[model samples]
Target chain A: MKNIYSTLPVIGILLLTLVSSALPANKPPEKGGVLPVINLPIPKNPTEKVYLGLSGDGFFKIPQIKAKVVIIEIYSMYCPYCQKDAPGVNELYTFIEKNPDLKNKIKLIGIGAGNTPFEVEVYKKTYQVPFPLFPDKDFTIHKACAEVRTPYFIVVKINDDGTHQIVHAQLGDYPGADPFLELVLKASGLK
Target chain B: MQKIRLANLIMVAGMLSVFVTVSMAFAISDAYKGNIYQVGTIKPVDSKLVVKKGNQAPDFSLPSVSGDKVTLSQFRGKKNVALSFVPAAWTPICSDQWPGYNIIKDTFDQNDTILLGITVDNIPTLFAWINQMGKLWFPVLSDFWPHGAVAKKYGVLRSNGVSERALFVIDKKGAIRYIDVHDINKRPPLEDLVGALEKLGK
Candidate 1:
């Protein structure tokens, strides 16, 4: 009984130290709450709330990109990771083509948000992207989306009432179109 | 006899406590996440001269995919090594870019350069993926175990867990002569790499 009573303080001190050390000492910044958002205003492009722009071909309305679901692909032309993942992007484009329903539900747009507009244009031309790519030169669009990294993927879902919601956001690349397709199908209510 | 038994128990308990403390120290070191920079002055490893100019050179011993054994260092001195670093292998950009290195294996050989890729990924995952991708020519080095120790030593490992995609033209003396660190999203120009090699050869 004496030993147990004497050991209680040590045990309590150990537990307290462990618990205090385990907790984060500092809190991370809150999204949009701080003045950091003041750096760039959300893109009021009008067609797409944050991501949409005038179609390079001048055929479709900014938000009316041909699919029930839209993918806003954020990338810089010079990022090796982005270049390495270029084949997967091509594969995704092919994957969408193979699934008519999935294709109808999905629209992938390449956004050059990282590099200069000239560099982005050269990259798009070199890669021969099938979808329209817009250069977010000043990062207004990026600021609007609150994007933090290159090669980010944002899945935009169009509601029946013509409003949009960010259904999914991914920072890094994952292979195959299955994961992306599933998200699109789920968001768009496509069978 | 009772005193002897108690002495043995105390020694055993002391040994066990020491072992626990050592293991905990190791765990704390391993639990280190985020980037930790090398504590010394940044070393400049660019523009030096050495041997093995334009010839298939001899190989050396380095860590293998499992990192358990050293297998693929033989290509080191023989060919010009395109020391490529990617953020992580599984991500989209790394996935596409590593295979692109494979696509240019013939070109690398034409210049007598063996393209060596490095990342902080553990040997196990790297072994499986390299085998899956069938990247036969390039031997990917695992900067794991020591936890990107090589990258940290080289001053390329970012404050993040991964190292930046930096290209180093390591000469035959194993001294890096040309160093280029690109933006995370940018791929180093292959032409610039070739030019660096040509200049080194000259």
Candidate 2:
């Protein structure tokens, strides 16, 4: 009876451990992968156009960002996960803006996976997202990235020759703005 | 022996407490992942729609997820209504469809339209399902109890006790302006819905 009582507690503890350590559905990806230059539309907003160091209209590419490092966030208006992470993403943008050195070196942009132009506008207005957001109404960006799930993050380092390398690619939410910013900076060798 | 029994009971209780806490944490933060069911492709659409365009929308008095009784007549003269009849809750296409409307509150308002999402699922099921979706501006009405009574009235109740993926746009004067019994496997394009609303204005 004594051994059974002792063993029951051990078994209970194991069950508790199992429940607590349930496997995550999608883990934040580790860093590495060089990507082709991604084409992007010129922001209609005049302020956004100037921030990205672009002129005229139509389309531009990721390497065109004057910053040394660029952070691209792939989100969807329909995704609850993206909605949950919006505030953190906005804070991350703000954190970069407040820092003089980081602000000039890092830039952030977002792509609305499978979202129309109108839908992307609604999301931006709803969340008050400060960064330049583009619509992928045709799922072009989504398919290019192997249909990455919403709320995915990718940090890229812009090269001298206009090509960029993917330093980090996380499939789900990050730790937080500060921690994730540190991760991005470290991954880009900026820290 | 009684003391040993007591010890075992205490251990089980402790473990349950830990388990419950972890589950609650996950539900609060990442509820979307665990709640969704991935049902693979079925028939594109299973039911034949009974109501056609220009039919006075069969009036329904279904219970909304907000604990209020919603009637189609309520919006008759005051506001136009768009009835979205989705098949079921927690399914693949059904899950994201409503949340996709979450950002377009303005578009509906501009057209003086009130969207009511109808499903055969009960209120409790809907509450649990929508908790992860944040706050939806429109009321999600349940067509359960008589089990898809409202859906059946509109002729969308499927053979499998669900509804067809359908949309009905009714004008403010209570005339059914458009009906699109969309393919169940795919989402009806937003442009089609928006165009219908825009036409209503003209």
- Give the number of the best model, judged by TM-score: 2
Candidate with the greatest DockQ versus the true structure: 2
What lDDT does the true structure give each of the candidates?
Answer: 0.54, 0.79
A1-191, model 1: which lDDT tens digit per residue?
A: 55665555555555555543333223221211211111222233453332233334333432454456677676656444455566677667778867765656666777665344455555656566665566655444444444344566666665566556566666655555667666656655664
Each prediction's TM-score versus the true structure: 0.42, 0.76
lDDT of 1 at B141: 82
User: Clashing pairs in model 2?
Assistant: none
**Regions of candidate 2 where Cα sits further than 4 Å from its true position:** A1-30, A36-38, A42-46, A54-61, A161-163, A174-176, B1-31
